[model samples]
Every structure is written in C-alpha cells, then in structure tokens.
Target chain A: EPEVTQTPSHQVTQMGQEVILRCVPISNHLYFYWYRQILGQKVEFLVSFYNNEISEKSEIFDDQFSVERPDGSNFTLKIRSTKLEDSAMYFCASSEAALNTEAFFGQGTRLTVV
Target chain B: AQTVTQSQPEMSVQEAETVTLSCTYDTSENNYYLFWYKQPPSRQMILVIRQEAYKQQNATENRFSVNFQKAAKSFSLKISDSQLGDTAMYFCALRGNFGNEKLTFGTGTRLTIIP
Candidate 1:
C-alpha cells in the first residue's frame, strides 16, 4: 500500500538555528497534515494543508512555523528558530479525501534541539 | 472543541489472551469519524480500524475490533489472541466531516503482550 514518507528520520539542531523537515504524502491524496507529540503528551495538531494553502493551524504553530508544498510530491515544514521545547516526534499524514478514508502516516521525524 | 481521552496509561496481557483498551471522546458534531492507530517501536503510526459516527455497527479488522457507544461517546479497542507483536502505543482519534477540520488524538495507551 502507498504510505506517507518523511525524510531525515531524525534531526538534531542547535538552539536558535533553523530546521526544515520534509515529507512526501501519499500520491493522489488531497489533504495533508502535520502533528507532533511531546514525550508523553497527546499528539497535537500543528497544521493542515489543502488546495495549496493551509486550511487550519493550532495556537502552537506560531510565527516560527511554516509549511510549503515545494513541489507536487514534497511537503516541507520549516522552523525559523528552534528551542529546547521544540524537540518532539513530528508526524506527517495524508487522507485520500478526508474523513472515513484511512489516513496513512509516515514513520515520523524525531526533532531534537539542543 | 473535541477531545479524545484514553484513561489507561498502560496494560499487559499474556500471549494468546485478550485485552481491551478504553477510549472516550467529546464531540457535538453529528457526523464524524473515529479511528484507532497503532504506533510500534519504530514510531510508525498505522491504522488499526475505523468507525463512522453515523453507523451504529462496530468496526472489526482481523484480530482488532471496536466497541463503539455513540450515545455515551465511548470507543474501546479489543485485541483478541494477543501476541508479542501486538505491543505498541494505541491512540484514539476523532475528526469531523466538515471542511478543514483536523483530527483530535488521545495521549495513547501502551499495550504489552507478554509470552
């Protein structure tokens, strides 16, 4: 089955530095999303992208975060400045249409800022 | 706002035994979707099963099944004939059918299947 794929399974960056995480969502799927999980916390929604624009974003996704569909298959998330608290597992998911359909997920990219 | 809750932090079951993980959600939307995702050690989130809010029947996939109570807003996952491979973190998620709606996920339940 086709699945979402994320690059740089793990990312380590210095505090105050910039980082860009890349993901290739399942082809033919329309809706794409990014979620993050702090160690033992719930998976929090960061942003949802569709029709070439961000549909919705959470309060956590402040000025530092931005998402781009750089290409037909590549969707990237960039953090302007990293902080220690920014360390977490970031997941990329995509659904064929949206609801009722299965949204496949990538393994995830573990981001660590020190 | 919608919230998904998983009360049990961790649960263990012997090999070949059965285990059930509890999940509860709060949502006023009439049409929505519920899903159970399994995250193994690799941290890959895989869909275990899904249930549509409009449907009254429970959803079952292989050894995985769900007990959904729409009225009570309770959705529980039951794993029959558990195996060591079944050990993983299970998350319950909810999403509305409306536009641009994102999924809300619970913290997760850590399930362990022992030998």
Candidate 2:
C-alpha cells in the first residue's frame, strides 16, 4: 500500500534555530495536513493545505510555522525559530479528498529542541 | 468545533480475550466520519477501521469491529480474539464531512494484550 513518507525520522535542533521537515504524500492525494503531538497529549491539527495553498489553520499554527508544497510531490513545514516547547512529534498526512476519506499518516518526525 | 473523548486512559486484557475501547464525540454536524487508529511501540499511526455517521450499520474489519450509536454520539472499538500484537495505543478521531480536512483526535487509550 502507498504510504506517506517523512524525512529525518528524528531531529534535534537548538533553541532559536530553524528546522525544515519534509514529507512526500501519496501521489494521488490532493489534501495535505500537518499535526503535532506533545508527549502524552492528544494530536492537534496545525494546518491543512489544498490547491497549493493553506485551506485552514489552528490557533497553534502561529507566525513561527509555515507549510509549502514546494514541488509536485514534496510538502514541507518550516519553523523559523524553534522554541523548547516546540519539541514534539510532527505528523504529515494526506487524503484523496477533503471529506469522507481516510487521511493516511506518516511515521512522524520527532522534533527535539534543546 | 468537534471533540473526541476516550475516557479510558489504559486497559489490559488477557491474550485471546475480547476488549472494548470506548469513545464519545461532540459534533453539531450530522454528516461526519469516525475512525480508530492504532499506534504500537514503533509509533506509526495505522488505521484500524472507520465508520460513516450516516450509516447505521457498524463497520467491521476481521477481528476489529465498531459499535456506533449515532443517537448517543458514541463509537467504541471491539477487538475480538486479541493477540499480543494487538497491544497498542488506540485513538478515536472525528472529521466533518464537508469544509474540514483536519481530524480531531482523542487523548488515546493505551491497550495491552497480556500473554
């Protein structure tokens, strides 16, 4: 089965540094999303992207975060300056449609900020 | 806004036994979707099963089945003949049928199938 793939299974960055997390969604999927899960907490939606632009975003998705479909297959999330509280597991997901379709998730990229 | 609640934080069942994880959600939309996802120690999210809110018939996949009560806004996952491999953190998620592509997830329930 085709699955979403994320680069750098684990990443460690210093506070105030920048980090880019990349994902390659399923080829046919049109809707892409980014979610965050702090340790022992529920997964929270960060942003959703469709038609190469952000469709919606949550309050947690502030100025520090940005997502881009930089290419035909690559979706990337960039953090301008990482904070210690930014440490968490970041998941990239994609779906064939915006509604009534399962959003397949990647293995997740564990971001650790020191 | 939609909210999924998994009241049970942890549960354990003997191997080959049956286990049920409870989930309740609050949504004003009549048309939506519900899902059960499994995350093992590997920490990979796997979709175990899904159910459509409009459909009264529950969804089942092999040993995994769901008891969905639309009126009560409840969706629970039942794992029959559970094996050691069934041990994982189960998450109940909700998504609206229109205008929203994001999934609202519960806190998750840690299930252990003891040998």
Candidate 3:
C-alpha cells in the first residue's frame, strides 16, 4: 500500500535554531496535514495544506511555523526558532479527498529540542 | 471549539477477550466525522475505524467496531477477539463536516492485551 513517508525519523536540534521536517505524501493525495504529539499529550493539529497553500491552521501553528509543498511530492514543515516545548513527535498525513475520507499517517518525526 | 474526551487512561484485556474504549466529544456541528486511531509503541498511527454522523448504521471493520451515539455525543471503540497485537494507545478524533480539515484528538487510552 502506498503511504506517506517522513524523513529523519528522529531529530535533535538546539534551542533557537531552525529545523525542517520533510514528508512525501502519497502521490495521488490532495490534502496534506501536520500534527504534533507532545509527550503524554493528545495529538494536536498544527496545519493543513491543499492546492499548495495553507487551508487551515490551529493556534499552535503560529508565525514561527510554516509549511510548503516545494514540489509535486515533497511537503515540508519549517520551524524558525525551536524551543524546548517543541520537543515532540510530528506526524504527516495525506488523504485522497478532504471530506468523509480517511487520512493515512506517516511514521512520524521525533523532534527533540535542547 | 470541539474537544474529544477519553476518560479511561489505561485498560487491560486478556487475550481472545473483548475490550471497549470509551470516547465522548462536544461538537455543535450537526455533520461531522469520528475516528479511532491506534498508535503502537513504534508511534505510527493506524486508523482502526471511522463513523460518519449521517450514517445511522454503525461502522464495522472486521473485529473492530464502534458504537457512535450522535445524540449523546459518544463514540466508543470495541475490539472483539482481542489479540496481543491490539495493545496500543487508542485515540478518538473528531472532524467537522464543513471545510474544516483539522482533527481534534482525545487524550488517548493505553490498552494492553495480556496473554
């Protein structure tokens, strides 16, 4: 089965530094999303992208966070300046359709900020 | 704002038995979707089952099924003939029917299938 693939399964970054997490969604998927799970916390939606632009975002997705679909296959999330609280597991997901459709999730990228 | 609640923090079930994880949500929207996702120790989330609000008939996928009470704002997951592999963190999520694509997830329930 085709799946969403995320690179750098684990990443350790310094506080105040920048980090980029990459994901290659399923080729035919039209909607892409970025979600984060803090240790012992619920999975929180950060942002959603469609048509190469942000469709919606949550309060957690502030100015420091940005998502881009640089190419047909690559979707990336960039954090301008990482903080200690940024340490969490970031998940990438994609769906063939937006409404009433199931979204497949990637293995997730674990970001640890020191 | 919408929120999902999973009251059970941890639950254990013997192998070959059945287990149910409870979930409740607060949503004013009439049309929406509910989902149950399983995250193993590996941390990859797998969709176990989904239920659309408009569908009165419960959604069942093999041994995995859900009892979604729209009026009560409750959606619970039932795993029948539970196996050791069913051990994982189960999360209940909610999504509105409009153009909103964001999913609000519950705190999660840790399920252990003991042999």
Candidate 4:
C-alpha cells in the first residue's frame, strides 16, 4: 500500500529560527494538505494545496506559514520564524480527489520549538 | 463550517469484548464523508473505516464497524472482539463533498483494551 512519507520524524528548533518539513505524497494523488495537532488537542487543518497552489487555508495558517510542491513528489511546509506555540505534530496527507476519497496521512513530523 | 464531536474522552474494555466510541457532527452540506482514524502509542494516524452520508448502509471493515445515522448527524465506531492491540486514540472526522477538502477531526477518544 502506498503511503505519504514525511522526513525528519522529529525536529527541535529554537524560537525565531526557520524550519522546513518535507513530505512525499502518493505519486498519483493530486490534492495535498497540512495539518497540525497540539498535545492533547484535536487535529487542526492548516492549509490545502492543489494544482501547485494553495486552495484554502485556515486562520492558523498565517503569513509565516507557506507550502510548496517543490517537485513532482515533494511537498514542503516552511515556517519562516518558529515560535514556542509552533511545537506540535505536523501531518501530511494526500487524496486522489477533492471529495469522497479518503486522504491518506503520513506518520507525522514532531516539531518542538524551544 | 464543520465540527466533529467525540463526547467520550476515554474508555476501557476487557480484551475480546466489544467497545463503542461515540461521535457526532454538524455540517450544513447534505453530502459528506465520515471517517474513523486510530492513533496508537506510535502516534501514527491509521484509517479504520469510512462512511458516505448519502449511503444508508453502514460501513464495516473486519471487526471494525460504524453506526451512521445521517438524520441524527451521528457516526459512531464499534470495535468487536477487541484485542490488546486495539488500544489507541480514535478520532472521528468529517469532510464535505464540495469545496474545501480539509478534514475536521474530533478531539479524539482514548480507548484501552485491557488484557
């Protein structure tokens, strides 16, 4: 079974520093998304990308956050300046279609900002 | 806007017993999708089961099944013959059939299958 793969299972960065989380979605899938879960909290949608552009984003996805499909399979999320609150588990997901299809999730990247 | 609610924060059941996790959701769209995801200590999100709002028949995968009441806006997961490996956090999620493909997940219910 093909699955979304994320690099750097765990990362620790200082406040005000930049961090890039990488993900390689399933090759055939077109829609991609980035979500985050704070410790003991529900998963929150940050942004969704399709057609190599952002389709939608939540309020939590502010200017500091950006997502790019750098290549055919690589989807990356960059945080220009990390904050203590940015510490959480980031998940990458992809789906074949925008609706009715299940979005497969990656193992997740745990980002800890000190 | 979509909101998924898992009322039970935690639950425990004896091994081989049956356990049910409750979930309710609010969505304006008539057509949508519901899903149950499992997260074990490894913290990896695993898709367990899914249901289409338009389909009245519930979805079942092996020992995992769902009771979906579209009228009541309720979708619950039932794990039968639960094993110790079934212990994990379960999240109920909702996604509309139209624009915005993002999934809205519940707070999650921690389930423990005791030996």
Candidate 3 lDDT at A95 equals: 92
Question: DockQ order of candidates, best first?
Answer: 3, 4, 2, 1
lDDT of 3 by residue, B27-91 (tens): 88989999999999999999999999999999999999999899899999999999999999999
lDDT of 1 by residue, B1-115 (tens): 8999999999999999999999999988999999999999888898899999899999999999999999999999999999999999999999887673688999999998889
Candidate 1 chain B worst ten-residue window by lDDT: B95-104
Off by over 4 Å in 1: none
Q: What is candidate 4's CA lDDT for residue A26?
A: 97
- The fraction of reference interface contacts (C-alpha pairs within 8 A across chains A and B) present in each candidate is 0.85, 0.82, 0.90, 0.87
TM-score, predicted candidate 4 vs. hidden true structure: 0.99
Q: Model 3, residue A83: displacement in angstroms?
A: 0.7
Model 2: residues with Cα > 4 Å off, grouped in runs: none
Report the CAPRI category for model 4: high
Per-residue alpha-carbon lDDT of candidate 4 for residues A1-114, written as tens digits (9 for 90 to 100):
899999889999999999999999999999999999998999999999999999999999999999999878899999999999999999999999998789999999999999
Higher-scoring candidate on DockQ, 1 or 4: 4
Question: Clashing pairs in model 1?
Answer: none
- Winner on DockQ (1 vs 3): 3
Chain B alone, TM-score, model 1:
0.97
